[model samples]
Target: MSSSNARTQERELTFEEVDAQIQNADLSEFENQDDANAQSLDLAAQLKKVCSVYKVVKPILSLVGNAPFLPSSWKSAVKTFNSVMSTICV
Candidate 1:
């Protein structure tokens, strides 16, 4: 055989070797996707818990903000809370 042909043959993988490599890559992709899904679920659960607390606290803040001998800074803090709740709940 020519030198170039011998080199090419040496570099070529067998079909079974190529298939095994592909299968390994697919398995790794599945593992990565599982990790991604678990992280997504974790974030969703945390948000749900936070929003639950937001439901209880928002109206109390509103009531306190409206009818209190508080300073302007307290009102501003309530506005900040409202803005944050709007961002998160939507």
Candidate 2:
């Protein structure tokens, strides 16, 4: 086989190994549902700290909407920006 084909086969095996590892990963290490819920609450608090900064910056983004020469794509940009913020909150 060509060296390139051999390299491609090796890369495929590496990807399969990574996929298997990801599939086997779990939160079952946690003792119970309450333990998992507590960890999630902790994570939410951490994300809330990051989201506080967005609260300050979102008003700045709104200022962009007031620009006279805003491009047609400005709406799409605003939509995408809001989506990102919403995802972080979720």
Candidate 3:
């Protein structure tokens, strides 16, 4: 076989090995359901922190976006940002 063809075949084998590893990956792996439950609680606490920050910021953003004489673009951007933040709270 030509050198280029041989090199391509070798690369294919390496890619297949990496693919197998990816196929076996477990994103939320744990030893047992009890461990998974612990992880869930940790994530819930983190989400609560985000919700607290959102509660504090939402009112300020609303006031800025609603103020008279502000540039329309700035108001629109703030409105979009507020909507996005609201979705992440829960």
Which one is best on lDDT? Answer: 3
**Which pairs of residues clash in candidate 2, taking residues 3 or more apart in a chain or in different chains?**
none
Candidate 1 wrongly placed segments (more than 4 Å): 1-41
Supply candidate 2's per-residue lDDT for 88. Answer: 78
What residue pairs clash in candidate 1, if any at all? none
* Alpha-carbon runs more than 4 Å astray in model 3: 1-45
Task: Give the higher-TM-score candidate: 1 or 2.
Answer: 1
Per-candidate Cα lDDT values, in order, are: 0.58, 0.55, 0.62
Order of the predicted models by lDDT, top scorer first:
3, 1, 2
Q: Determine which window of 10 residues in candidate 1 has minimal summed lDDT.
A: 24-33
List the candidates' TM-scores in order. Answer: 0.48, 0.39, 0.46
lDDT (Cα, 0-100) at 9 in candidate 1: 34
Quote the lDDT for 87 in model 2: 72
lDDT of 1 by residue, 1-90 (tens): 469645633554444544554454423323334656657667778587566556445545555555458888998888688778857865
lDDT of 2 by residue, 1-90 (tens): 569645743432343544554465453433254646556677667577557555444444544544448885895687578668857754
Question: Model 2, 23: alpha-carbon shift in Å?
Answer: 48
Give candidate 1's TM-score.
0.48
TM-score-wise, the better of 2 and 3 is 3
